[model samples]
Target: MQKLAGVLQNFFNQAHAKGRLRRECFGNLIYYRLIDDSQPFRRGTVIFEEGTLIPGYPQIGRMIRLDKGLKEQFTKPFWAEEKVDGYNVRIFLLGERLLGVTRGGFLCPFTVDRLPDLIDERIFSDHPDFILCGEIAGPENPYLIGSPPFIKEDIQLFIFDCQRKGEFDYLSQAEKHQLMEHYSLPSVRNFGLFKAEDILAIKQLMMTLDTEGCEGLVFKEDVPRGKRSKYVTSDASLSDIQAMARYLPDFPPEYFIGRILRSVIFLDEEGISSTHELKAQLGSAFIDGLLKAIKQCQREHRVYHRFRCRLHDRANARQLLAHLARGDGHIQIVKHRLVREGEFYIFEFDKVFQRTTGLLGELLSGEMVYD
Candidate 1:
């Protein structure tokens, strides 16, 4: 620990001066979280005082054109897995304690509190050094406004990759599958192997998933040190626009523009004509979403996404709320947000999109913009 701290002192000092590195405590654990990329360390990198380091999850490049992207990106057979639409988190065992760290390098109290219901503790007991990377998705999640149609109620964890404590490279697909099967772990569905030339098969799969309202696929090469790329379904892009249209001003125009372009390309590539139903779906995604936002602002004087989750401990719920309060003026936790329901505590809150809320409020109240 002393040596590692010494090695990191210069970088830490520079990062601290820039307000990019943050030192936070989770109970007895003292750690440093990188709020932004600083030289060699990426944003979301977490380093513990006791020498445990959970590196930030790397961003996977997206493929807009599968035919060209596959041939250009991969030289060998690759395995395709369903890309679940949810927040990303890394779960690890720290001195017999199971903890969930979010993509932003924060120790999530909500995820930690609900870990028992998501995974078997025996996997941690067996492999204490394992860093399980996965997605936490469903309606009951506190982070996302949208959830996959498959999960009706509570959230579920789908393990997609595994890494050792000190290693940067992920385990191969087969190795990950072996461990998952042995531990009876829930994982993303695999769509089998495909070579670069298997464009027709992949297109068929993408269309099938799009029809079912599921997200796209992530293609992982089978080699020991292979690369990965992601491709989302047109429906997934539309869903994103539909869900986030209420907070449209909060996001860049590029966000919606990029999705629109992808949908157009996807439809053209699949050789599908723009039918009336398809055009109506696209139009309603924006119109309906904006209408809902307007109504919500008129009714409540705010535009926000409501989030709910279950926790085993009330203290963790408080901790989660406190952590959120430390962020920018986006999260709003009411007085009675935490309620004891049966054995577990039901925690609820709202993620307020301040820009959209303010704009809508002014417009509704007859305010005029010069621009």
Candidate 2:
């Protein structure tokens, strides 16, 4: 363990000096997280002091044209699963403890506290070395504002992939399904298997999901370590724009532009020539979101996204707040934000986007500036 620690320390020091790594701790576990890709390691990779490495999840390329994307990307049958709208997390058993690590490699205290409510802990007991990759989504989730329409209350976990520790590849689809069934784990809804040429059927499925107000679909090849691609619905794109429009300055121009393009492509491919309703919806997404931000700033003197989550332990709630406080000074958590409600502690906070807040404040105050 000492030799491993020394080697890890040396690598972390170099990476930290180069602005590519960050070091943090939760209890007795000291870990190094990659902030940027460095040769063998991808961004969000985490390495613990005892030498457990949780590799970063790879980015899946988005496909605008289903017909061309499927043919060009997959040579074999692929499974189409619902691409949920939520923050990604990787859960694994470290010793006898189950912990949740976010995609950016941070040890999330909130997720750890809520794990039992989300999944069957016996899965970890059965497969001690398996790392569960899943999405935790709902209106009450702390990270994201958007949630699937189905989850009306607290967050829910939907396991999508599983990988063993020290292995870079995910388990085969069949293997993962078998384990999920055995454990009765909540998983992303599967739309069945499809060959590359099954574009019509896939399109029909996409339309159904869109009508049902789902995020989109992810196409994962049947084989182990197979390639993956994602395609989102027009409503999802519009919702994303609506939610983030208040903090538009915080994101790149391509963020909004890409969604617009995707929505257009989806409409065209679906052969929807009448776009009056869509145009109105898209317009309201931007206009209404910005209007709400203006009203909020006028009333509260600040603009932010309010987050609410519940934890079983009060200490974990405090710890989660502390962890968020360590971020880029945008979090606002008051003493009254953490309150006990029956058996759980409800915590609420706001993530202030200073760029948007400042910009709006200036504009509201009649400060003229050249863009």
Residue runs of model 1 more than 4 Å from their true location after superposition: 1-18, 38-40, 330-336
**Against the hidden true structure, what lDDT does model 1 obtain?**
0.87
Model 2 spans > 4 angstroms off: 1-19, 328-336
- Measured with C-alpha atoms, the lDDT of residue 199 in candidate 2 is 91
Clashing pairs in 2: none
Encode model 2's per-residue lDDT on 1-371: one tens digit a residue: 23355665677678889878877889778887898777666788887767777888788899998888899999999999999999999999888889999998999998999999999999999899999999999999877878999999989999999999867799988899999999999999988999988999999999998898899999999877788999999989998999988878766789999999999999998988889999999999899989988888888887888888898988887788788777666445443488889888888877887777888898999999996
The TM-score measured for candidate 1 stands at 0.94
TM-scores of all predicted structures? 0.94, 0.94
lDDT of 2 at 136: 94
